[model samples]
Target: MKIKVINKGHHALPEYQTELSAGLDLRAVLSESKVLAPLERVLVPTGLYIELPQGYEAQVRPRSGLAFKHGLSVLNAPGTIDADYRGEIGVLLVNLSNEQFEVKDGERVAQLVIAKHETVEWEPVETLSDTERGAGGYGSTGKK
Candidate 1:
């Protein structure tokens, strides 16, 4: 799938790190370093704009290494970018550790995964079919 994008930052466009990667890394577009104190959250811009086709969305997610190493993660995990939005891509980053973290210009902070979705139509019904589990959730099945 092809997407139209505009990059105003100094770094190259977001791309997958490997051949089989599902997400593309997004970088911070800051002129200087920005500090995030412990438990602080901020919106970090990527200076990237994209036009996605209908029935598709761009999901912004956190990098695993950053989360495990620095306790930094996307405040809204898997943040959704609608197909109609045409604004700069910003990531909501939060510091979960007890120390401050510095975000530098063009630093890889988050990732973008383009996904295809479906919209469901409402169907009025009197009753629904039942299952053995039947709406059981949140550890309903005992762990072995």
Candidate 2:
């Protein structure tokens, strides 16, 4: 499933670390290091533009190492990139720690996962079928 991509910066293309890895590491393409204060968020560009096939979408997710070590995370975890979008990829990052975090050029910031999605059609019905846990909201099930 090779997709078309355009690299507009000097950084290497995003790649999976292992053979079975589902996501590719995305890097930040910054001119200079940007300091992010606690609770601050910024949009970091990747200088990558991709063309995904129809019914497939790209999801921008956080790197677990960055999130657990530096308290940095993708603001919109699993940010969706539609198949029709042709703009550069940007990662929305937020600092959740007390200390300021610096975003350096070509630093791995996020992970991108290509996913297949289904298009739903309107199946209007008078009422939905009922089950034992029908209409149950969040946490309706026991914690155990």
lDDT of 1 by residue, 21-54 (tens): 9999999999889999999999999999999999
Among all candidates shown, the one with the greatest TM-score: 2
RMSD values for the candidates in order, in angstroms, are 1.3, 1.2
Q: lDDT, candidate 2, residue 75?
A: 93
Per-candidate TM-score against the hidden true structure: 0.96, 0.97
lDDT of each: 0.96, 0.96
**Tens-place lDDT digits, model 2, residues 1-144:** 999999997899999999999999999998999999999999999999999999999999999999999999999888999999999999999999999999999899999999999999999899998897878789987644
Give the TM-score (vs. native) of candidate 2.
0.97
List the pairs of residues colliding in candidate 1: none
lDDT value, residue 49 of candidate 2: 98
Error of 1 at 47 (Å): 0.5
**Superposed model 1: Cα runs more than 4 Å off:** none
Write down the lDDT that model 2 would get: 0.96
